[model samples]
Target chain A: MTGPTRPAEAVITGAGLAVAGYAGIADLLGPVPADRDGDPLAGLSRRLGRHKDRATRLALLAGGRALADAGRPADDTPVDTGPEAFDRPGGRTGVVASSNYGNLDTVCGTVDAIDAHTYTGASPMLLPSTASNVVASWIAITYGMRGANLTLCNGATSGLDAVHWACHLVRAGRVDSVLVAGVEPGNDAVTGLAGAPAFDGAAAIVVESARVAAGRGAPVRARVGRYARRADLRDAVAAVAPGPVDLWCEPEDGAAEPPVPARHRLEVGAQLGRRSGALGVLQVAAAVAWFGRHPRSRALATCGRGGEASADAAAALVLAAPEDRS
Target chain B: MPGGIAGRGALASTGRTAEDMFAALCAGRSGVDTPRAFDLTRYRTRHAFEIDDRPPGGGDVPMRATGWLLDAIGAALADAELAPDLGDVPVLIGTTLRELRSAELAWRQHTDFDTDRLHFGHALRERFGATTTYTVTNACAASLYVLGLGLDLIESGAAETVVVAGVDTISESTFGLLDRCYPAPPEALRPFDRHRQGMLQGEGAAAVVLRGTGDARHGLLRAVAVNCDAYHPSAPDVAGIAAAIREGQSRAGAKPSDVDLVFLHGTGTELNDQAEALAMAEVFGDTPPLATAIKCMTGHTAGASGLHSLIAGTDCIRTGAVPAITTLQRPMDEAAGLRLVRDTVSGADIDLVQVHSFGFGGLNAVALLERGR
Candidate 1:
């Protein structure tokens, strides 16, 4: 068997978050009430948000916020300088999103229409939204990201896997940076399938190579450290955390006990709702916030599909605080 | 670059094995027929490339797509002389609609199936002993996208062996959408033809095993490049396709002149064909590489189409025979100067092959494969 290799280090430059009853990532660290909020897509233009579903809209809001936070253009404003116009950062920016139930509402609705009115009754406009990658596609289209675009519909670990693939893209030299978003909506259809109330928001992070972040003068919040996926949770934890950690963002429905001990433990799902696909990104965002308060402290975020069988893969990643606090 | 392809498998209306499928293609056999899986009485045209025979397992499966996927994986493992259980090896799946058809069946017929099956990881873990699995749904280009990820996993030394598969059954909802979008269903799918009509849906699964430190029985994966058009949702972008082709070739350390054959993503749609032709012209200039479209016989397999082309391209390299697009009577005006394969060419000198997959949402992926030494 081939052992896992330590990938090149990437830095998290920006983060965007939207959760019910919470204002920002800082709020996630402490306790918050369970209250509903207004429409997340209230300010988006009708032209851009014409036929989008709830998950897509939430992803757009969070993705646009992250891009803006990174000091990059958030919307698809045409740059008409010359042939080298696309040579800007947007040209090399890619998007990777994770959403297990992103398009369930659209799919169920379309299927219901087919059952009632046959083939002719299905709306052509809503058909494209049924694809699971619609969220990532919309984010790329809105931001004009022409790099490698991907969407992960993997099970519970999808959010962390999306982040892993984003880092993979940067390390492989495929793209300069990647916009990673994890979104899931608690619509009736999704709730029915999940048999539980889902989180109705998105979390996004901008992960770029350290060299690119330095070149572009972007502030590095945290450095992406070792990442590993193993059949067992203990192996994953051991692989990622060879050294001690300051904070551990434990998976909401993960193992009953912590695999690796940390100074402090934070249950993201307890503070926020059961975010499903958005859980991993939210965990990383909380870690970034913690690093901001305590410099040079390391954090480990772990996630997995909980089970006794070894087939239930677990993933873990280390996040180190930036060296220069200034 | 990714590791070599140790084994490959396929399940389509054309055939179950790659050899059988390629033989049917060379003999000019078509798999398109009237739909038998679902009712199509109210539709204007009722035709799809439906598979009649059940997979290796019984037909009484909760999710037909899962059954096909398991069968394909089994076949791939057997071909590679590996065990049925994948153990800790990672499995990467690509599908446009994962168990959505099963959910539709439940909604329509009140069939009882576990909702957790919607996410394929549960079934994959239970049946194949896969510890890590990634499922990607990037429209029709989903399979190639996952294949690219599988390559990265092996190249990065994250795993020694990886299983990559793509499967999509007929989604009644998607079928209905296509029925309303197209003017009328043509008799057959004639991709890249002058009088080609829109494409018909097809259902199937394809899989390949990549091993970093083992004998590559099939061929070597040179490179895979993926990009989003970021343009219109349904329209194919020429720049995106050209960029993917150029990036794939550049990653493989090959020039435009080095490519011997190209498997076009000819979906028999007006916009798709026009855009693909323009992209080829932009990349290869006046005289492009010898090209062929497998959708003429297999129909458009949607998400599984990319792997279908990749497997067929591997077979072409092994046999030195390129199948003909029998449905192509005349090339389109834009592709007139292109060398579209007409008849099956035997003993042809082919070393490097390129495959193209473009899907809705303007997702584009290209892969290059070299002949196994």
Candidate 2:
């Protein structure tokens, strides 16, 4: 078998985050106060937010911010309004979201309702939320994005997998740009299942092809570098990183430390609390923020249920500052 | 640009193996029966297409869907002449409800349920040594979406072989939702029928092995196209479905006339069937290709329904036999010009086939398959 070739590169143009104690990507670089209480859905209209679950609300907030930060008009804008609306056509932008326990509360509630009152008693408004893809669908519907929409509920690596697929979509020319979000709500339902509090927030990144980014004059925060998924963390690190990186965002529950050397190592879960689905995207967001502070540097983000006997393959991704890319 | 379909497998109410399911479908067998998985005394619709063989209790497996998925994967690997351990080959499984049923059961019975089992990665790794696995929850269009992603992986040289599968068991909550939505439960799932009431939920799993360089004994995946309507959450959009079909044909370098058969996403639901039929008319003009809906016999398998169609389409390409919608009493008005197969057609020159799978969230996916050389 031949080795997989490096995929066509895409650049991260904008990043948005709404984790607890942090409002955006820039806030990740400093200490998060314990008592910060800003509303993630501050700007969302009640009409649009009606019947939306917590995960969907967080995704919408983060997705809208990312698009705005990318210098793109709101996706809800009328397509025939003007030429500026054509710059970020709804038909060309896609959404890829990851959330493992995003809809557990809705599912549990619906099941309870059905159990108590039968099918006739179930709420019609909650019917759509039963499907796991509700988060991604809501983002697309809110933003009027008609491109390929996907939701990954994959295990621990889902967040990074969303990023990988988002970049793949851009590189494959399927979509001009993609909004990738990783969200998980720390509700009682999810807390009970997780045996601990979960991350009650979301993180989003705007990924587009280099040419499209250049054409749109969107600032390149970081270029998507090498990515590899292998059975062993060492193999994945070897495939993605050949030299030392400036920073490494390690997985919180990963059993073994990554073998690759790095100048600094950061753990996302250490600062944000227990995160299952949002860890990977948060890592990428942190890398982007770190790159802003230190130009011409590279960062590696790795995630998976490593060391567990039944855990699947580990994933590693390398991100480079825009100026560092040749 | 096409990935070779090295092998395929399926487990449904109609049959176990892919070949068995195809034979049953050709024989006009219906798997719909009284619901056994859950209590449906209050539901107007009590029938569901459920697998009879139950997996034995014991082990760390979370739900019956996992058992079905593992069995289908094993069957596909065996058919493909590959090692039991997939090693580095990535596995992508699509579904609407992963293990939500298990959660429901636990919540109702107050039994201890491990939340870790909600995802199938651990089980897949432990059973098949599959290091890479992705569980995509794209609703009903999931399996076909993963099939498209598998093609991209192979075409991009990411992997020489990739396994794509779809599995979903009857979630009581989903069944209840459908029950409330339907005005009345029809006797059976009648797709494209003038009096089609609605669709019944089914539990099943299907898998297909895709190879970049290998003998494609089943068929070649010519192209796949996916798009979101972004119009409505639950309603199907004519424009989105039409766009997917046209885009798929364009990517496959084929015209509407070149398609020999079309596997409709006929869910027997009023809006879904009407919207799909209109989309077909928009894409194929006055004369559409020969079309059939397997849901009539298998009772919409939810997420696995798309792959169920693909498996049947592959069999048609291999055996030159096309199954008919035996339950269709009267074809709907929307599909007036299109040819809806009513009786089994044998020895048909079916080379190029198109499969459509649409889901809630207005997710539409279309895949084109060509006869293997």
Candidate 3:
């Protein structure tokens, strides 16, 4: 009880994983479907019908898993998705979803319909969902988390930045918990459309304040402390998590790591794909889930993209094993 | 972790720079005109505000929003006197349709398929060498939230300085949706008026440079808050919108008495105006803040509307003249607590400005701006 409150150390009480044609973290490594190319949204038949676009489905699946992993209900008691309709553990829960290409399939498709025929040709209903917030809105509505709904699209930094944002809000005492989702639903057709083979899949995590997690005695999957500018493993990592630290980040961001005497390695980005804003969170969630079985080791998830194209864009999320509950 | 609005630039149908745009609005120059973004011959009404300026050899490329974004960013950098090389500076851009117009061309034509959606970020990063570029598209409120995110970046030490931009180009689908959503005789756009009919479709792009207190030049931002209704996708709940407004005020530590002006989202739609009125009553109590809906001047810029409103708020704080809502000849009957600005009200000692932005599907954001003190 007598330790400095790590500005960035929030407990990752729950984690969720979902990719194209998959349901939740259970199916993450269960099996690769023989008909992988077949309809990726067959499981969502009862939940959604016509407008179940790729981005929306990915958000829902990942969000559902994250909620369940946190020991919350998959769906809130059917209530209005309004401010008065929802209740939160700490009165506020935010969802920040990151993406570079936001609902592009519907955007391009609607534009195509308009071009091929006319305004009357394209579905008016599909036009509104083109906004990137649709993903965050769908996630909040389905889960009934009503703190905030924000969507950030800044290449791969989008995912990690969303994490930083959630951390900042919780630290600021604005929200009690945040459900962060990094979803792009990557594919060849989409990557080809974007002119890069850099993205595919979705990942989510439930981040609550260290005080809240400690109060409820929820087993902390990992602790992310105050976000330092340079992920110098020494200062950025909280004192409470002092141990032999291992850095987990994508290959692109490995170039910036300081020569800290710790086990530095790459985890999810390489296998997922490459060059995506969603990698930041995917790798963070991947590392959190990785530590589920292998406790005692500290893992810091970092990712970045900068230079000739975007301004200096980079972020890092520190995760470490919790102190003994006993 | 408070931040300041260092610099700003706007490119709407009315004028380009802040001074020019404000001058046009003060001179009663409305940007509303017939549709030039697309052909609306068969629609009920085809009124919209479309920009006339084009980049050199423009329309030659599939992505037209690129040119507008570049121009706005360039202006913002110059206005803020920031260096062109944005090393370690995060860039946040907001756009509902990054380049849907380009997609329309690629779809109908076999030879011109170049509607690449992800090129906006790459193009800016390569040209400007930014830290990172972000695109936020939460419909009309995207730009405001993007600005809010910029504040988060500075507060979290992600970047000492950040550039926020909002850009949206009108296309056939946008005009079509606007035509159907508020199918009224759109000779002009009117919000908060008793006879208010619909919002005109407008294309606009704007940018602002935000920095910590050390770098803030013109004004300071007390707080920025955004939340979702979890309500219907198309309809907004008055209670939800009011809750967001109160939360933003609480975060800013500002009472209704501290606010000198309020920039209503004022989309000119009936439901939006009424909800905003009810929200004002809930927040300001008996003494409501002076309100102005500027869309009647610039029409509705959609995603870029928030930036436009922020720009107008900055002018109000600096010049001490609140631009009045022009189309409010017959104000809404329920707007008792709202001090509507019907004409140019000047010579007021304005300190704090509260701005509201709400989008479809229950996305709501409110930002509080204070004159540098």
Tens digit of per-residue lDDT, candidate 2, span A1-326 = 11354444689998887765576787766666576576767766787688889999888888877888888757454343221222246777889999999889888887778778888888878778899999999888888888889998876778888999999888776788899999988788887666775778888999997888898788999988888777767777877764888888887664455567789887775655567788889889999999999999998888874555676667889899998954
> What does DockQ come to for candidate 1?
0.51
User: Candidate 2 lDDT (Cα, whole model)?
Assistant: 0.85
The sequence of per-residue lDDT tens digits that candidate 2 reaches over residues B1-373 is 8899998899999998888899999999989888876666658886889887655552122488988999999999999998879867889998999998888777667567777778788788888988778899999999998898899888887889999999999887888888888889777899999999999888899999999646588989999998888877899888888888988998899999999999999999999999999989888997688999999989888889999999999989888899999889989999888899999999999999999999989898999999988
lDDT of each: 0.81, 0.85, 0.69
Could you give candidate 1's per-residue lDDT for residues A1-326 as a string of tens digits?
A: 11364444678998877566656677768876566466656655677677888888888877777777777647455342222323456657789999878888888888778768887788988878867789998887787887788888776677888998899898876688999999988788776666676778888999998888889899898888878766666878877764768888887665567676689888885644467778888888888889889897888888774456523577788888897332
Q: Quick one: best lDDT, which candidate?
A: 2
DockQ of each: 0.51, 0.56, 0.35
Stretch of 10 with least lDDT, candidate 1 chain B? B53-62
Stretches of candidate 1 exceeding 4 Å from the true structure: A1-8, A78-88, A271-273, A324-326, B53-61
lDDT by residue (A56-105, candidate 3, tens digit) is 77667667777777776565444544445534442388778887665766
- Model 3 bad stretches (over 4 Å): A1-8, A20-42, A48-50, A77-91, A186-192, A195-201, A225-277, A300-318, A323-326, B41-45, B55-61, B108-120, B152-159, B212-217
Candidate 3 lDDT, B1-373, residue by residue in tens = 5798888888888897777888877777888776654545445675778786544543424555777788888898998888787744667787766665665555444335443244365567556765445666676888897787778777767677899888887766566656655646666667788888877777788888998886666688878888777666657778778887877777788877888899999987878888888878877888887888888988888778888888878888888887878877888787856798888888878889888888876788899898875
What is candidate 1's lDDT per residue for B231-252, written digit by digit as tens? 7778888878888898889878
